[model samples]
Target: MGIKEQIYNRSPLFLQHLFTTLYGYQLHRERYGPVYQERFRMLLEREHTTIDVKAEQLDRLNDFLHFCTEHSPYYRQLFASHGIRLPLTDLSELKHIPVLSKEILRTHMENIQTDIAAPIIGKTGGTTGTSLQVRYTIPDMQIRMAHLDYFKATHGVYRGMRRISFTAQDLVPERQQVDVYWRMNRAANQLLFTVKRLSPRTMAAYLEAIERFQPETIDGLPSAMIELARFAKREGIRLTCQPIAIFPTAERIDAEERQVIEEVFHGPVFDQYASSEGAPIVSECRFGQKHLHHEMGIIELDTDGEILVTSFDTHGTPLIRYRVGDRMTLSQRICSCGHPGPIIESIDGRGRAFIQKPDGQKIFEAQLASLVKHLPNSIERIQYVQMTTDSVSIYYVPDAERFSQSDERLLMERLYRLFGRDIHLDVQAVSYIDAEESGKILLVKSSLTG
Candidate 1:
């Protein structure tokens, strides 16, 4: 642990709250300054306009392309090699540029970025055990924050409103035996709850804390919220706190989980799709439709539904044609909510969650699922655990009547064909597959550090 964390752990509960509030104040200043205010107002005003969305987007895209060509050495060299001229008249000209993969970003991050004074650094959650660090300019950060705040404001959630957050952040000390699993951020009026060590035995404390605080909004990881909601439902306890809305981040929420959350909390769930790497946002409207904010970025989908984003806000580390490793299906049906942006049918979580082979190839989640797709109602759920490059353990929940020995043999044959002779596949039938330490259920869990 760092020295500051050690000091925080050693301090009394009251002091911890004070420290959290002080830190929150610093963040508030950084995120909610005059730039943020101006950007937020612009966003709110833009929502009401029937302006030519595509034309404006193309203009912004051209400007951003010009900036990247001027500032970033990687993009300048790459574009020059492709004979791509800047200030393209049409958006279709983007096809001339090469797609920037995650591997490219990992290898050439420094070259991808423009040198800026004291840029804000953010890191990905490293769900695949390969974390990515991204830098943002102050105005970029402010604009991103403005977009988020404006989205929430549309749902009747605002800054300084009483809110409860359950996230992967470790707020409570591991060794501390106190029942308090939360810290206060008075500057943002947020009660931050730790997602660690949550169980039925300790859930009452969380509920009690929520009841006492009576927050207007709830935000954080969907898995954590689902756990709390499931526990409450199982215990036949209804929360007294009626939040304006529940905002889920980091992880995707299925229909069942969303229903449970809304049922327990007595609020609507506004889902958002964005990345820690500062990808452009696709926020759920109050009408339950997901809209891509055209002002923020351009999203293009490959044949496999993988999205390549060119975010205008990523000036510090301009992400032009960045393959973000997530999949989504775009919708042709216009949303009745009257938002003048493209609608997304569904956000199909992360497409890049994969198990690495011994020879450094990867078998992603979609490809792995194809092995059992031919089976008829046999498998309920499946998970792959990779501790080493050469071997993988598959835990599967099977239907008793349908999952025959022949089906297992067929699965084994398919696995061998996909993995080749060098790999060892250990497929086991299990009643249940466990979630990760953060309570999120991952299809692929690899301990082979990237």
Candidate 2:
């Protein structure tokens, strides 16, 4: 546990609420107080009928059009260079503008930022490793959180509710600190279970902490939840305490994984399609129907099948027609859930899957990932790719003086234990790994079909 755990966790309930109120005030207040919460309530009560949602989105889209050209350096120069007029009248007019790729964002980061306030820079710890960084205004960050909170509330989660998150935070920075794996975010009533120290050795402590906290809701990556499930099953342990819901985010969840998760926890898993770059794309309803948040932006599927997003919600960085690198199969049929939005039939998110052997043997990606948990703290990125049925490649980028040949050999030895002795492995320490042009990471690439 950390110092915040010692200080905040020991505080009384009313005192904790006082801290939460103060922090919420500081975080949400921009031009005035109460607008954030008021907006949250408005969003909560309003039933987003498709037509109303579209009209509202278009209004925000129009406002953003004029706002971006005036305030954003990149969009301003791009429009000026192309001789495109300010304040487009119709959505059809936007067709002339090219889609904003991740390459553009990475190259012209400062240019895309709105000159409103000092921005908070955040890094995305995705499957590609911690390569993608984004900037958000403080108000925009608060709004995003509120937006997520409201969505969670739709399915019965609320503020100050007991929740536990299993995410990719460096909680126990030192590997030797075995006793400390989770810390209490007392103000928010959240228990954070870090992913780095989540192997079988630390599984017991994690379960104990989960039981101790007795969370009302479970949130975070599905990969981590599945990790907990696997650990519990292997050790002949079961989670007696059940949460109201399992909220999965920041990663993809397949049918098999989702089914196993539902069985393990005996709770409904509500999945959401979101990004760190201020795009709240789609969400799953209580009836397991996925609906597009039309109020969020104008989401379109291009000819190349890339999901292009124009987020009105992004004030810090107005991403107009940004090519967010996700491919999805969309549905047009009206949902049985009575939600008035188009369904996201499927999403191919940037998540790694398990590799399967020819003779019916399969390896869980999370299990392999736990092996790499012992890697040095200086390691910035890690990726393991399957080239052939018998061949594997490990690609990693390390901070200077952080990784060595000994580390590579050690990882290979660990892989050999899982894979047979005849398995071919190539481990390389590179300066950087390549991503899709739109900056999406493909964690695992296999030549052989599953």
Candidate 3:
């Protein structure tokens, strides 16, 4: 290793900003440009922000249709075959455009190309052990960040703050023994930490880095935060530093996990709902209201509860009426936060976590998390591996020294209560649960083709 690897002196921070300045121009600069800022500021400033939702949706929907018909051969052929006309005046008329699926995109990827110059290929984090590749342009990147900037404001996270985040970056080498686990991004004041090496052994090194940096906000997935809290609590390590707020994304965080993280850091965990397809979907406010970013996309729910999104401003890879494979419930009540927008009642993580019962009934993984919620706060990470149709294994990480036998029995009982007599449940308490290769933590995985 290097001698000055973990040291974040002025020279290192300056060199880091150079890369961040060029690379993050679209994320930081384009999103905060005068034009983008004006529109974003107006959205926040408008007191009586009552606009015709159906009309705006129809207009944006038609605009997307017209663009697709002109540039994308796949969309053009589909629209022509289905007799879809431009200038849609009614929102219900969007039904004519068939829902675009990921399989269809893969099959006709070239046909969907808009002839943009040297487009970038975007990959989904593949939380379910499978990765998806999609083509995007510069404009698509801008719209994604603009949407992020809009919602981040709701949680009091402005640009250029000292935001410490744990993402899929490979800043730290896997085997290196370093004093710090984080690297400084001087341009944005972001302390980037690698989530690859947060085992029980090196968890103390991570705490040392955080204690030194003293970041303003903590932005990362819930799995990372929960595991950190588990190690701290288990070791009886008291953190004298706390962030202003915590922002979690890209995973399903149950109420219990959020409470533990909040207690450990002494901050509120503001969770967000988004997809890897460059669509910013939902966010929470101070009043715990989940607001749908209507200005970002026109969101709709399928009969099966799949979230269909149309990116109104994404010109690079326009996801018009795209089935994002996630479910959401719409709320009729307005937000008490005084933000005039549509609200989402709830957002179920991904469609992969629906575990089946013995009676052929399916239950969300969040429902199973409730069983352990009544248990002690020692449970940190939870994962279920369905070995077969009649056999299942659950692996969990504990904050205490070890999992007690009674705790194991209670966990088994919960599984039996969930899957019933037809299935065999095996509970194991381990040091840690592995994240996906793409660095996403999946709550459940099924190997059986049932």
Candidate 4:
């Protein structure tokens, strides 16, 4: 066996991946740093090249799927059971393969592979239930990182620039070793904020952190960022540190939330979609096109309103036609930026999160955010649960003071006007509302069928 293979197999799967990261750090310093800068320069050039040429991306999908079918035991068994095989020349042929769900991963957890040689590992956090751990190889992880760089460069965010990452990280007991990553990222000139402590007081602290740090970019789940924006606006506090760009991840960036963020930051907002199971897959450009990161994998938009993704970056526990619980659509036209890649008009969160109407006036959970402006009281956080087409339960987590009887009546009246009196409004109080494990707040949760 080759020396590289020997060393890789000897190391623990997770540790081998860590060493790979160390190697990536060197690669970043010696090669990627310069190359990526040039790539960024080209990306922002007057005449930009198409990121992944259509012909080449088509070819890569065949190789990627075939690799998964061969190396990933879980996918191999799934394909065999479902009468599926890989190596299709055309991307359109992916339809023959059924979409795999998070439930399948949870059930067949052991069948997922761990590449001891060229070792790798990963985790699918907060999707179906608890976060399920997955593994990946060195090549897989590097490809994913490269794709991130490609997307960041495409949107004018580079490595050296200061970035404030507002994500979930615990302070006491030091939850994960990865918490160090956030700090290391900060020391490397990026500031990181923990949404684990995102209260009104904590948000004010976040504002102070931004002012002191002066981050060039802010990246996090859109919900937390929007809440901060709303807090800033209402409290008459303006953060002097207006980042050049704000990249919202982990959740759907609805129009109402977008408007508020843009107003607060006084800049354009870029949205990207990623999941615990999938690599950072798609990014929206300034022209508002949600272009798939073709280099990482082929992301398919099935007519069933599901996103089926197979990544070139998941060699450890490779996913083939993996259903990532989101309902997204491909854009019908080329972007105004002249990029040939597909545009994502919006992400409608998860299936369980969508609200269906018999009258066909389907509503998304995020539509509840619009009611905030319409509410009499300064609504801090609200969770709406649609039990049926005609019934929904509204749970309001009011601000500092308790909701008065008159305030409750007015809020109820407005909600009735919107969803009708048929919907049951159940008012409840909580210390604070939180997003799901993926760090996404469900503005509306439907008790009905997912």
Question: Which candidate has the highest lDDT of all?
Answer: 1
The lDDT for every candidate, in the order shown, is 0.78, 0.68, 0.66, 0.61
Model 1 segments beyond 4 Å from truth?
350-450
Instruction: List residue ranges in candidate 2 displaced over 4 A.
Output: 1-33, 48-51, 125-130, 354-441, 445-450
Better of 2 and 3 by lDDT: 2
Candidate 2 local distance difference test against the native: 0.68
lDDT of 4 at 128: 25
Whichever of 1 and 3 has more lDDT, that candidate is 1
In angstroms, the error of model 2 at 18 is: 15
Q: Show where candidate 4 strays beyond 4 Å.
A: 1-47, 50-54, 77-86, 114-120, 172-187, 350-450
What RMSD, rounded to one decimal, does every model reach? 12.3, 7.4, 12.8, 14.3
Model 1, 1-450: lDDT tens per residue? 358978998998899999999999998878988889998999887776687888998899999988888889998999899999878888888877899876577667779988665368776532332235678888888888999998899999998899998854557765678899899999999999876545566788998899899989999866667778888998988888899999988676788989999999889999998876778988999889999878899899976667899899998878888877677888788889888766898876654456777665555543454445445346556778899888999887776666788878776765675666677888888987787686545768788744
Top of the candidates by TM-score = 1
TM-score of each: 0.79, 0.76, 0.72, 0.65
Q: Could you tell which candidate, 2 or 3, scores higher by TM-score? A: 2
Instruction: Estimate, for each residue in 1-450, the C-alpha lDDT of model 3 and write its tens digit.
Output: 124433413234455445544455545654455656565666667535677766766776777778878888888889889988778778877877888875455445568767655265665623332224566665555555656766777677787777888864445543345455666666578877766445566678887778787877888656667778877888887787667789887777778888988887778888788776666567888888788766667787887777788776555566777876567888787778866666787886543264555544443443444445434333555777876566678777765643466766766765565566776777777877787795656767876433
Clashing pairs in 3: none
Extract clashing residue pairs from model 4.
120-136, 121-135, 121-136, 122-134
TM-score of 3: 0.72
- Tell me the lDDT of model 3 at 30: 40
Per-model clash counts, in order, read 0, 0, 0, 4
Over 4 Å off in model 3, which ranges?
A: 1-35, 117-120, 351-450
